[model samples]
Target: MYVSLNRNTSKWVVKKFEENHNHVLHLPEHSHLLKSHRMVSEAQAINIDIAADIGLSLKASHDLLSAQAGGKECLGFTREDQKNYLRTRRQRSLKFGESGALLGYFRNQAAQNPYFYYAVQLDKEDMITNIFWADHEMITDYALFGDSISFDTTFRTNKEYRPFALFAGFNHFRMTCIFGAALLYDETVESFEWLFKTFLHAMSGKKPITKGKRMQDNGTLIEPLNQTTEHLLSPKYSRSIIRID
Candidate 1:
């Protein structure tokens, strides 16, 4: 196709239009791969966000959507496209800096639900060293099933390489219930101490009768666990055990 500017009429006119293709055209089955045909719809975008929030990998989310849509050919977008979308969305979210955005999100949550609780631990330089949060559901769950709990912090899968900690327990039916969660800058004893203290405060000073935690060979968590046990139990409840796995 070709167009020319017509100075007399100040309008563009088609000078040449070729009806025949110069090269082999894409087959119908492959047409969906074309740039013009590829797009992530609003509904699909929402599903992607849901999947990401639930910790689904890009490939897994894409495959699930593909299956839902009957097949990849009908999914309207590629996995790379989904990844690019998430990358751009994350970049946009950090426009005000990651810490600012995180605090803003927490503020919004607290505004919507008074039971939402969160705490940020800072260093001498006033930079965030760790963060902990638990919603109303988690708080209520803790009150009901906080007798025995497990804490884990081995996850460091995000881009920042921060340790993601989760405080969880089982309900009466043996279903897992989350009491709280945190992101730590390091695995040091100080970080764990602050996290445990904040968690106890958030749960209204309710202590688990039996606490379970994974043991790290570095021995950094030993001091924190010992200190936490002293504060977590009364003289009569001293039999509470700190199970190490």
Candidate 2:
């Protein structure tokens, strides 16, 4: 506010009552001064690419480049600029390597195992939907001590994000052993059913015999035992269902 006397009446009067509103936003010093690379030599660019391909650490690569430049500054460039360039180059290499590499690996593994059992489900377009496998050793273990099988589908790996299921059970040595595994694209009832059936088929229709069950029904649960020299019938399964027992 400002007060002054009128020129003709010689009286004091208020000129303005509101506070000053004019202001300007101020930035910090050197805000616009970005230290950027003005020029990168062709030899320096080539050295950077070579060091990155050899899997050198970013700091080490920068230090080597610095030493090559005779202790001179990076021609207005910073270490961060060189690091970003290396990262982009490495990512492009990984993208190209991922194409068809994983499937080829699986095929090679299948070829090496003569008695390897594998199943693949396809979609309407004939693309692989799901795949499962059990090796020869796994089948032998199943035939020997195939009781109390436990299956779990709680793992995922690789780019496809497929759920990996493992069929595990205890052996005669009282140690956990894997019988089979499956890579499923989705978690559905049909997928689970097919997985269980495939596991049973791989073991040559041999169901693990159950030993103990407290039943209220008068009917008996009989299990076939004709695998070896023992012809004795084994007691398996409950009166209500026809599951693994």
Candidate 3:
């Protein structure tokens, strides 16, 4: 197909058209796989957001949507499309900067729940270096099942590659429960010190009786935990134990 501009009418007109094709046409069943036909509709976008909020992976979310739509061929969008959509949404959400957006979100949560606690650590340049947050439910859970808590920093965020730490324990039902979470700039003793202190403050200074850490190199983390214990513990709980696994 070709088009020409008609100066007299200031209009573009199709100048040439060919009935013969250069390649075989796509099958009707595969039409949805074409770029022109693939799209993430508004409803699908909402479903994707809900799925993400529930911690669904991109592939899982896409597969779920495909199942709902009867089959992958009827889903109208590919997993890559879903990934691009979510990526774009995250980029747009951080329009004001990631730190600012994070602070805003924390503030909003705190507003809704007065028991919500969050602390941000800044470097010498006043840039956010570490962040910790725990909601009211988490605080309550900690008060109940925090006697033996585990801390792990092996997980990392996909985009930032920052250490994503979790303060977790088990409920009476033996199900895993989260007490708090943090995003650390580094795995340094200073970062861990700040995170542990902030976590204790959020849980009303109730130090875990036994704190377990999962790390291959426990030397760096042990120092911080010991320092935190000495600084934050009362004489009555001075015998708190630290375990490494």
TM-score of each: 0.52, 0.44, 0.51
Measured on C-alpha atoms, candidate 1 has an lDDT of: 0.75
lDDT (tens digit, per residue) of candidate 1 on 36-129 = 9999999999999999878888899999999999999999998989987885565444333565677889999999999999998865545566
Please give the distance, in angstroms, between residue 52's alpha carbon in candidate 3 and its true position after superposition.
27
Stronger candidate by lDDT (1 vs 2): 1
lDDT of 1 at 239: 34
Each prediction's number of clashing residue pairs: 0, 0, 0
lDDT of 2: 0.59
RMSD of each: 14.2, 19.8, 13.0
Clashing pairs in 2: none
Residue-wise C-alpha lDDT for candidate 3, range 86-167, written one tens digit per residue: 7566544433366577799999998998888999886554557778999988999989988877666767675544578887
**For residues 201-234, could you state the per-residue lDDT of candidate 2 as single tens digits?**
8778776554433222224432322222112111
Worst 10 residues of 1 by lDDT: 232-241
Instruction: After the best TM-score superposition of candidate 2, give how far the Cα of residue 114 lies from its true spot, in angstroms.
Output: 1.9
